[model samples]
Target: MAHFPMNHPARPIYRVLSGLIGLYILMFGVWGVVLTAGESLFARESNWALGLRTNLAFSIASVIFGAFLIIGASRRTNLGHYMNLTAGIVFLVTSILMMSLLQTEANFLNFSMSTVIVSMIFGLVLLGTGLYDKVGPPELAEAERRSRDKQISEANTP
Candidate 1:
């Protein structure tokens, strides 16, 4: 039960988002591999124009990436924030590229418009979480200031 740095305003949000996204990706990879039986997983016809080719290799890659996100979130470090940001960018870009290559049986993420939209939304959310501290609310800064003051006073009392 590791705790994030209390002073960072968006630490909690980043941790939660990263963990959720990582879980989703890990499950998705498992689904892809199990459902397709490793065959035709990478085939374009399997889904659509989505950049994700759900073969054994891709599935393993997804799991690895998901694990990275999970570990980052658990660690609650700057590295975690950057990892989330990077994952968001990658997902968004891949989905967009898939959309651009759409065909009659082609679309992003399982040949569905909904999946594409969802991916983009998730991307934006991750990006926002990652950048939240850059212009954090005044209240958060004040709270941190007060907390530090309390710690200093407590230390002096001893």
Candidate 2:
């Protein structure tokens, strides 16, 4: 029997969430770049930080990240889940740091209260989606195997 990696019950949900997050990130980056006209590529104009500055560099990075998520979702690869999990953790940590250093301007990253809130939200969503289903459902897995086997048999018949 052949293996179907994306036969998990939660695969669809995970992929949808991943795609949505990717699109959001991509749009955010594109919007920022357009608004700033690339002048703030490496500038500190925006308070967002944690290698996610509101500049061109960050925008480009965000777009790439988004693209990865989208592509991973389309391909139904486990890598997408791992990447989302990592990104969630990073964003959450960054948000916490931003909140803690609200009084100081020289914090590792310069982020505002709004930025922290947004980051936290994004982090939670990513984490939730990534951790949705570590293991595939037993019934679904069996069904998937059967379906794949049937397809293979039919293909071989012709």
Candidate 3:
């Protein structure tokens, strides 16, 4: 089974970084909403916010998603771990899909290349944070550490 660090020493740092990303997204969404208020839901007109194109539909979605991430990052339990993992995967998948439809009429989100790039970056960071943010009881963490040490020793012996 794959090992995800539990009770990592740097978990606080990771959480802070994730929260910062969430804040940025939230601000971007708010700005997008203000800028795109008079436009159609999925308007193709040029509306940029925080260096990314936007529309009412996309801005609203960003608001919700950003808030979700913020909540996840603020949690102290395993909920944050699972939430970050889910959000990471969603960002990655959605970015890829949007990138594919960039030139077509199907790009309802009005995702520019910059937006896809930022999403991919945020996805990777969130995924990494999730991998290291798992928390468990002391005994479980010790057992996991021992298991990791054993695996490392075995690999070194070979």
Candidate 4:
């Protein structure tokens, strides 16, 4: 028997969430790109210890991931299916890590709040898209139906 996979369209919620997540990624990427390019203005005493190299590394990573995320989300590629969930988790984890990285009296406490809010936004998008995922379950259902048909046919055969 020939085998063919079924086509599945992403749910509306997933598309919306993916786009929003893409935009969020773009925002961070732009922020990083700007900071890296214009380091002199945003430079702080604390950042001195972090060094230029570290900042550049992080900025580049942000830009790549953000741009890819936007593309993946817009394209709705297979890889994007995983990236969405992973990005959401990553943002949440990073937000927590950032909170701990800061000293209690750190001047950038507001940054923490912003991170938390952004993290929550990603979390919500992930939750919504994941819950509304349209592709995965249908395939499982199709496979199950085929299995049931095979079992029935086997039982009927003498």
Best candidate, lDDT-wise? 3
For model 2, the stretches where C-alpha displacement exceeds 4 angstroms are 1-8, 46-53, 107-110, 133-158
Clashes of each: 0, 1, 0, 0
lDDT of 4 by residue, 1-158 (tens): 53322333555557667776666556665665555565543233322111221233455565676676676566544455566667777767766765676455442322344545666677667655644443445668588568868989999999
Q: List the residue pairs that clash in candidate 3.
A: none
| Winner on TM-score (3 vs 4) | 3
Which portions of model 4 miss their true places by more than 4 Å? 1-10, 35-59, 104-111, 134-158
User: Relative to the true structure, how large is the alpha-carbon lDDT of every model?
Assistant: 0.62, 0.68, 0.93, 0.56
Better of 1 and 4 by lDDT: 1
- TM-score for model 3? 0.95
Q: Could you tell which candidate, 1 or 4, scores higher by TM-score? A: 1
Model 3, range 21-138, lDDT digits (tens) per residue?
8999999999999999988999988999999999999999989989999999999899999989998999999999999999999999999999999999999999999999999998
The per-residue C-alpha lDDT of model 2 at residue 126 equals: 79
- State in Å the error of residue 56, model 1: 5.2
A best-first ranking of the candidates according to their TM-score comes to: 3, 1, 2, 4
Model 1, span 1-158: residue lDDT tens: 32223336556766787688778777766666665564554444453113444545456566787787778677644676677678789879966876675564443233345556756876887665656423335687678668778988999995
In model 3, which runs have C-alpha deviations exceeding 4 angstroms? none
Q: What is the TM-score of each candidate against the true structure?
A: 0.64, 0.64, 0.95, 0.57
* Tens digit of per-residue lDDT, candidate 2, span 46-107: 63433344656656766787777677566645676677778789779978976898667554
The reply for model 1, stretches above 4 Å from the true place, is 1-6, 45-58, 104-111, 133-158
Ranking by lDDT: 3, 2, 1, 4
Considering every candidate listed, which one attains the maximal TM-score?
3
lDDT of 3: 0.93
